[model samples]
Target: MGIHIIKMPDLGEGIAEVEVVEWRVKPGDTVKEDQVLADVMTDKATVEIPSPVNGTVIALGGEIGESLAVGAELIRLEVAGSGNQNGKTATPATATATAGTTLPGSPVSTVCERAEELEEAPAPVAKAAPAQAPLLKAAPPRARGLAAPAVRQRALELGIALEFLEGSGPEGRITHADLDAQLLRRVKVAPSGPKPSDPTDAERTIAVTGMRRKIAQKMQEAKRRIPHFTYVEEVDVTELEALRAHLNGQHGNQRGRITLLPLLMRAIVLSLKQFPQANARFNDESGIVTQYDAVHIGVATQTAAGLMVPVVRNAHKHDLWSSALEVARLAEAARAGKAVRDELSGSTITITSLGALGGIVTTPVINHPEVAIIGVNKMVERPMIRDGAIVARKMMNLSSSFDHRVIDGMVAAQFVQTIRAYLETPATLFID
Candidate 1:
């Protein structure tokens, strides 16, 4: 019956204008309310903006790789209900159930208010005017990869220009690794940080773009907006390792590569069964804590593109092998860039791992809404003193970070300990 304007919502901190990476709908296409219509690339994350109003698309603001400010008119829509009078636009205050389905609005974006605060403050003076001279090539928005904001700022500090370099990231954004490789050309050793190079001076350029960039933004919002606390415990995965090996040997690599992941996941699910209080999300605006009945554990995998936390949706629905199968499928899809839109989001809880790169311990960011994250590290063969004798054992560290506003310190510690019990005993996972 009438047309409506959907403005771009702010993505996150320090995010200015985002480049329209791709538009999902064209003019005259009917879209459902809350259906994703475009992918916007910020300095931090690739945001999928949904249609707020169910209607027919009338016009898209721009084509791919075009930048638009937050609050800009992104899409015009023609709704199905309400009468138009005097040739003016009109829409039903109440949605028509027959035409389209609208999901409840997701938690008030934690980043929106923060972005408003930043905008209301004083503006900075112009640093310098653009160069009129020619010959310097500028890389289009698509050329760079997934470096974090910190990494990009570091690159700028080192006097490295982003436009010249080739990106090894998803959608071709420059990454910290690409920068490190350049630095490697100059120095024998690489320094350390998120951007490689430890206690050294050689530097290079890194551009932040795509999902990994988004991961950084979400983590920041989680850290700032949500009150979080950590609870850590040393888990003896010795028995769990034997069980995993036996299962893998029986199934072999083709059927599925049995690893501690499924065992840990199974244990995590069972513990959630016991302690339902731990399985919850904090609603910041409503001042309520929402607990979930299903276990949708998000596994945090780091690909060459960036860190992706794909959910094993309804993880509790599957058996041990089925759980393994689902985990493998999601992980493989993520690494291959075959992950569907929904496959990457809507997690109730999460687990993050650094594979062989993980050290003795590291605190991971709590995936927002999910309230908690389980972090896994490298298995080290170390000397263990038991029964008055020292013996070598392969052991790994598990660290869990929780939103303190929802879960208290003691409950979190106990939750990890409960999971440790199943992992340490191993048979507890199989026993009814």
Candidate 2:
């Protein structure tokens, strides 16, 4: 028998630490090789960490929501074999100063070296077995369902049909709110419980941790470092609307249809040809600015987790339909919490919209390091003065922000004017 200490694996480049979101296996649980032990969330994505070897878990490294540094001790395990319990052939490993002794198992030795430098520790001796605690049985047969144990128990006590109730949680997992809603719909009352005597107007506090903390830090950093200059312009998108309707009608039968965002994105790319500063990144610390040849458009999307900006690579390379499809794919992936690291960064410019909920013009913040961000406002039909008369025209405002250090007022206005021209004319967008 041998004891092995598992260290947190390197997640990715530039990732120093990760937060433990959930632990799948408990101490004393027998886990198999490659079985998921926990889900750790980094700034980029939530990744599942799998067990490196088949072993009984002795201890977890940290509690939930605790941050663990890369290469830190993650978990301790007791295994039945000498070579990581896999019985795989071991390879010779060079002894390091951190370890006075080296094991034939290269993988285990490498892991231990990274975990910590123990001072002349000898091999672990097998200990006598201890009395096992009483295992808790699962809920009654009638309480069995796809919901969590607590939700299942509540539903069973309330005589709710799990099969009939629709889940509102991620991946169709039933949430307590879903059960409550179901109960309310049927009986117009919450689950039978004692009523509170009175409600007090007390302060409620929410911990500023997790994604919210990250967002606050990033936003503060951006605002503190970048000198923001906002520009607002109203465009007559009447013709653009017509063109969009025509394109959607033609492509409506397909799996992905055209939307105003794709059209606007293409127009933005074309407009960048006139003013490339807006489609560039500025490093204030190094006093360097980089302008990219290809336009990687970042679509600012709001998800249940928080605001996520998923980039659509090579926006200039794709046609209108292709860009629309890619945008749809990236947006869906971002909202579903499946966006990859590449898709979440490296955007030359960003576009934000509230869809139909877009109110009047907004002063958008420049995405940090990126020189500019384009904000799309809701389209509404309003009275506008035409050549000879006041007419009803579909109009929308483009609220854009720029890093004043890189983009000037005249240059920013001209860039937006170019976008407006393409949107108003609709035919200019096809001009190579």
Candidate 3:
């Protein structure tokens, strides 16, 4: 018998550390290769780490709910027929992972899955209520997912139909919310729950550890150190939206949904080319400005944990459609907590958009050292005087926050105007 020490694998690039969100297997528990050992929290992702070598766990290096740095020893296992049970033997890392595997008990994946299920489910419209009755009744027993005694009792108390809400929790169990919603819909409830707890006075305990700390540190540094100047431009996106609709019609649906952000990315790249000074880093080492030609645009995506920025390398090369797809893919991966270190690191500039939650204008903090950030707001149809006549046009605000130390206000304004022009006129997007 031999025991192998399992140090935490590097979750991804730029991610020097991670928090132990959960430990799936305890000491003395047998784990198979590729079986999940724990869920870890990183700056860019919340990942499920699998076992590199299979064995019975002997000792783990962390306390439950403590944060452990990446590459820290996480587990020690006793494998049959190796060396000493004292865990002096090295682990056998024979398998390599090309794609990320989901970890068990991840709340982020569960939330995403729930959102998709709701979206795919037939919308609960009052008009279609009668027509969908037969389908809802014929729904399979597997959909019910209540086969256990405790779950049955809870389901009955909530007045939940054993069927309707699908079980997503471990072993397909119906949960509290599922039952509550069903009960509420069937019967009315008198206001209970301690006569409405005062929200302003309520305090909840949250463990301030992991990426939350890192984010706080970064934001504090940015606000304290950098002198920021913001410039705004309202661009008419009617032409761009028209071009997008035309492209989607020609190339089919999957290839054509041109998100506003991609168009914004292209505009930023064009402006970056024109104003190369904006794509620069404030080198603390040399105390000088270092400029680069390659534009690495980081798209800020919000996850269940917090906000993470994942980079899209060389945004200049992608057109409207390709850039849209790339941003979408990166944002999805970022939200899923699957983004690696490299994806979250080395961003020259950042662009943040709230999708439909977008409002007209927002001030973005300079992603320190990078010199600039752009915030894209939602597009809305508004009346504008174009060519001496009032007409409705699709318009959105483009906001840029720049480091005033490196970029002058005039230069920042020009750069923002240039991007607005490129977006307002789609032909300039592909032009040299």
Off by over 4 Å in 2: 83-198
What shift in Å separates residue 365 of candidate 2 from its native position after superposition? 1.8
lDDT score, residue 6, model 1?
82
Model 1 bad stretches (over 4 Å): 1-19, 22-207
Residues 3-90, model 1: lDDT tens digits:
5778778876556567676799987689998999998866423568998778887677654644566776677777766512222422
lDDT of 2 by residue, 287-380 (tens): 9999988999999988887888889899999988888888888889978878877788889999999978889889887778899999999999
- Measured on C-alpha atoms, candidate 1 has an lDDT of 0.73
**Candidate 1 backbone clash number:** 15
Name the runs in model 3 displaced over 4 angstroms.
Answer: 9-16, 46-48, 69-71, 82-202
Query: Best to worst by TM-score, what's the order?
Result: 2, 3, 1
TM-score of each: 0.58, 0.72, 0.68
Q: Which lDDT tens digits does candidate 3 get at residues 321-383?
A: 778888888888877777876788788888888877788888888887789898888889999
**How high is the CA lDDT of each candidate model?**
0.73, 0.79, 0.74
Count of clashing residue pairs in every prediction: 15, 0, 2
lDDT of 2: 0.79
